[model samples]
Target chain A: MNEILTQSVFFGMFLTLACFEIGLWVKKKAKIAIANPLLVAVILIVAVLTLFHIDYENYKKGADYIQYFLTPATVSLAVPLYRQLSYLKKYPLAIIGGIAAGVLTAMGSIFLLSMAFGLNHEQYVTLLPKSITTAIGMGISDKMGGMAAITVIAISVTGITGTILAEAVCKLFGIREPVAKGLAIGTSAHALGTSKAMEIGEVEGAMSSLSIVVAGIMTVMSVPLFATLIQ
Target chain B: MKFLRQIAIIMGISFLAELLEALIPLPIAASMYGLVLMLLGLVTKLIPLEKVEGAADFLIEIMPLLFVPPTVSVIANLEALKSILVPLLVICISTTILIMAVTGRTAQSLMRIGRSGGEKQESRTVDCGKNKMKNKLATGEEEKTDE
Candidate 1:
């Protein structure tokens, strides 16, 4: 079974899709934030590989095919941003300022914490892009010589944290305005947070999706500047 | 055929962005360039929304699934990550909450300031009234849906 699976070039791709579908079903049934499809899929894939004693490299061989779409998908984020352009026009300062502040806070906090904890430069850079979408974050981390896998893990954790805490944080901060609520979630958590934002309201959903693009662009531009801090 | 064309356009832009990344001395990622280029194209009407909408939506839909492979690699590197796991968790959770608070407050205040400043103008009342009605309707529906 192991040999057959390893030899099949499409095994990893098939497994990923199948696991993700199961993840979708679980999310649909569970109706909870913790049941994030990506999180579920990751855990399921990890379990399957370990239980079957499949080598990571062999799985990665087929998995790389799916990973190839990541870049184009990142580029495709423009569509949603474009659709939400009206929100940008209506509250340019609020949206832009909110995302800018959030992006800065994300990077600043990571830098300070990394320093306080005595993390090395590579680890610092890896954590730098933790708050943005995984697609763009992975690219930034890779370009900066950080461990992309660690960066991916950090991004996922940040996203899940954002999704779970979104309501509590909003209430705690008294963020009544839909725009503010959306911006806060997207800036802090990326697309995962946007999922929760969509559930909250339409305007919040629009704003959250908008923030993903702006925050992504802002992070991509600013990561280099921040990366110089720890080095 | 239409979907294939849409994908071709996206890939073509990605290819161009890759070239730009290699040519430019800046540390910008190729994906950034592609995103900027795509946004610009859409804004300028160089690429109509119809042309890329289908493929773009499809791509975004499956985006999370694409990250599974890279994330799964974490298992192989668990040993190295163990030492810093506590700190990593601390930073991710703390900063996420902190960012949400800071961003929410900043935007809320700024929006309030804008509203107050605009409210004094008599000419804006009509627009404000319409907006208020819209908000009321939206919140009303939201409350109903909540139950």
Candidate 2:
């Protein structure tokens, strides 16, 4: 058992899965908003790896093996997407128009704020894709000459920020429209924040989910235009 | 057998989509190019929504797995996190709060519109129809049905 468990690939998967399942249990028992399962597992896995002193490479060997699932999962997201098709079609024009406005406003806001704060060119590039899903954000960062490391950093930071503050921001602005709320966070922070949005209500989750796909499209469309415009 | 074929086709499209921008000599990554092709495919109805729906749903269900590498990296960069933990905490919390506010308010407002606008229209239509039907029905029979 030790032999199998200690193998980096096996250990990482076992640990990741085990921690994830345990996170579910924690969520059940604690009933605390802060005790989100993913956050819990993230903390647990990090602690386990640290405790064993196995170092991350060995741990990653296990994780990377499981990580292959991420791409397929991304592709498979079309399932709920299909389920939501009718809902999407119901107000296609409003959704498309609203999402475009929200995404552009999000980007514009961040860009303006960053510029005011003296963000350099590299940081600007990193911040540009902060609202996208992390994989895409990382991809954009690498392709556009922003540091991959910084992009990931910004993505995670954006996610956690979105998670904690989505409602506060909405209320502060009196933006009680579900579409607006969902679009705002999903546009600016992507999946991590979207997960938090799910907790507030089903409509928000659906809207935020919609935001993810639309915002991905918006970001992808805008980057090239920005590249040309900047050059 | 049918589902398997569907999965394969979807994956194939996804793969094709991934590699589409290789022809471009632009500074952007090929995958980014692929996304464009995918969008075009989607827009053009070349790849129907159902074709990718199964796969896309599967991807989101297991979304956390995708973050494994970075999570491991977190372990690797334990020292760095310790250094920036405060900022990280602040950022995550602030953003989350903001998002929650926006989403909740939007849902409430939409719910209001749906409730108010839809209720009045439905009531007007249904009430008028119901009154007409009631007027045609015998009063005794209507009272019995109501009871």
Candidate 3:
């Protein structure tokens, strides 16, 4: 069993697909936001690997095939951004300013909080770019000598948490405008939260898509500067 | 065949972005360059939105699945993570709320300020309408379902 798990590429591929499908099924059955497919898949994969004592490196060989698509997937995001260009032109300053503010706040708060939390340099660096998309965030994290894998995990957790709480947060903050809601979600949670924002309405989807682009660029540009400041 | 071409175009743009990333001194990711380049292409009519919509839809729809492996790799750093998990969780959740509240409120205020002078923005609205129509004409069939 160990040999098959370690040596067979099909083993990892099958496990990942099966776990994701099962996660989808569970999400359908439970109908709860917390039963997110990504979250479910992560939990199941971690549990199974731990129980079987299968090494992460072995699992990653096949999984990396899926990971390879992340760059293309991220690039393709520009299509939606392009489609939403009209909205971008109409409210350029508001979107740019909001994303810039969110980026700065996200970086500042994470840097200070991580330091206060007594996390080491590696962990602090990992947590800094947690709000941006994986492709960009991973780049910044890697360049700064942070753990890319840890940044990936933190990014997912931050995305899921934001998606789950976005509506409540908006309501609590009295944020009624669709544009504002969308910007907030995308700026803070990146793609996953933007997916949720899409479900809310058309204007929200457009605004969220715009925020994803602006916030991604802002975070990529500013995270290094913030890193140097905090270090 | 059309979808394949669309994918090729997106990948080609990504390659250009990779090249730009290597050339640029800043820490900008190749994906950001790809995104900005794609936006430039669309704005300049170099690549119409129709050419990429199908491939883009497929890619974005499955993006969450792509991150699963990385998320699971968290198991490898369990010891380090376990100690910092609480603080990390606190920081993530609080910062998310803070970002959302701050950005949302700021955008709302800015939009209000814009709207105060936005009545004279008739030309921009018409410009957007013309662009939307052009986009609709380009992706007429898609507009039936997606718009």
Best by lDDT: 1
For candidate 2, write residues B38-82 as lDDT tens digits.
445665778777766555555555564456456457656555356
Error of 3 at A147 (Å): 2.5
TM-score of chain B as predicted in candidate 3: 0.76
Superposed Cα deviation of residue B143, candidate 1 (Å): 25
Quote the positional error of residue A130 for candidate 1 in Å.
Answer: 1.2
lDDT: worst 10-residue window of model 1 chain A: A201-210
Tell me the tens digit of each residue's lDDT in model 1 across A98-151: 889999998898999999999988989989999988757877898998988888
Query: Candidate 2: interface RMSD in Å?
Result: 8.5
| Model 1 steric clash pairs | none
Pitting candidate 1 against candidate 2, the one with the higher lDDT is: 1
lDDT of 2 by residue, A127-169 (tens): 5676677657777767776666655666776675566556657
- Compared with the true structure, all predictions reach lDDT values of 0.82, 0.57, 0.79
Report candidate 1's interface RMSD in Å. 4.8
Better of 1 and 3 by DockQ: 1
lDDT of 2 at A169: 72
Off by over 4 Å in 2: A1-7, A89-93, A112-119, A160-181, A194-206, A221-231, B1-7, B21-58, B77-147
Candidate structures ordered by lDDT, highest first: 1, 3, 2
